[model samples]
Target: MDPSILSGMRGFGVATIPRWPWFVFLAGGMGCLACSSLSHLLACHSKDFNLFFWRLDYAGISLMIVCSFFAPIYYAFFCNPYSRLFYLASISLLGVLAIIALLAPSLSTPRFRPLRATLFLSMGFSGVIPAAHAVILYWGQPHIFVALGYELAMAILYATGAGFYVSRIPERWKPGAFDIAGQSHQIFHVFVVLGALAHSVATLVILDFRLRLPTCAD
Candidate 1:
């Protein structure tokens, strides 16, 4: 691997910023997957376990959304310290809000599924401001466009996933017919993974662009 691709610590020449964004994402993803698997495997064990595990699963999803903002925003806005700080702060605040909102027992019920999906989608869509800023700030750079393209793709995929999640698609149409193979939830999970991978690629592209730019001290 290129050192530039992996060097997350040196944010715009600053060594103080920790390089755990990727790890944060990975941990979030793993936690989400683990929670989901456990929920499915053991929820049937009892009603209490079912409720608790499902809540854990929702928390894991919220965690993944929070972590997902780290890499792309960090790399794309690295050159503009104030912009970077603002975007990071905004997303962090949104993440906290999402967590708190989701944790409300009333909101966690099945009837509020649409509300939950909307909350998460809004958090993801909040990247638009930073993304637009990135493009405007780096208008002439090829990597900016490339990264933006990937980010756009990521957004679309995520939105589609949220649609599936909110609509409950095939499962809703055919009830127990899709209980095993073609459920909306399963499709939504696939899109979530794809969106994350797309974001990762975009982050790497932004990081490469940062590597080529002169340092802040220069």
Candidate 2:
């Protein structure tokens, strides 16, 4: 959001950056949200629906996490095909593994809430690898650091959300008071939305950086 952060990087005619990576992220976000909404809405209908939709919800979270990596990584590593491919493949594999792990009906229950949060948190934190790599590659670039700042905010928000989700606070602290409002899960969802917003800003920053100079030579 700060103009000065990107002031140093002069544009060499705006490059026509590919939009597929961005689209992938958007799709993932939408699908994850849809799955979560549906799960919450319909899971109470029946036991069978509960199992099916909750698993779907977990899988959708994995899908969104995996897709979130696309735009940032692809744009940051636009000049290096190998690193790009490796990161993308690694995340894809992790997502698949997470989905498989979460598909277990036992894991979806409140008893395994910690494990579920850990799995999702692990998937989210795995971005540190490529994020660090990008920082190193673009070291001293003001815009990159700004982007990193947004990412850091995203991480904090997500971690906080997960904490509430795992702890089940408010409601846990006072049994009947939070049943209708101020529940931990509701707070968790709020933080999730905030985290997603932060991530979006970071991604946009990276995309703008790449658009300024699409080619490595630039």
Candidate 3:
């Protein structure tokens, strides 16, 4: 066997996992957007509609958070089945808890806005654990650092969005000032979209990086 051929083989030994992360993110994003649009459009129709739509809207947020974990964890641990399974299971459980907590009748009230935001934010922040693990495992790789930076940016954007959603700022500052265009809720939505986009970018970067990492049997 040629030495160069052996070197080439070793260099290309990285594991390739399926692309289910992107699919999970796409589905979750669509679900959240659809629910949000429906809630906004029909909530004014009746009291029952208002209650139901709002609950769906909150549930949509929780669903998105859970789904957001799929890509990074799946790609980061592609060669490490144990870590991948553990992280996936942990996030799935968190998502279920978030959905149940948000769906609770009492927790859906306007008075519980901060509590709701806190729950979602906590779920999002949970990514830090897996992210930190990825860094520790791949500290020598530049792609891991790059992905971590993007993930951090996503977290900041999300936390900022939650702040706007919870505080009702700007709108509260000037009642009806933003009723038509720049309401805090609208701002929150924009930030949420931005955060999701950032997450997608990070996931893709991690996926590409994973493609270059060594495989399990290597």
> Which candidate tops lDDT?
2
| Per-model lDDT | 0.80, 0.88, 0.86
lDDT of candidate 3 at residue 152, scale 0 to 100: 90
Q: Considering lDDT, where higher is better, how would the candidates rank from best to worst? A: 2, 3, 1
What are the runs in model 1 whose C-alpha is more than 4 Å off? 1-18
Off by over 4 Å in 3: 1-16
Query: Which stretches in model 2 have alpha-carbon errors above 4 Å?
Result: 1-16
- TM-scores, one per candidate: 0.87, 0.91, 0.91
Q: What's the TM for model 2?
A: 0.91
In order, what is each prediction's RMSD in angstroms?
Answer: 3.4, 4.1, 4.3
Q: Give the TM-score of candidate 1.
A: 0.87
lDDT at position 96, candidate 1: 78
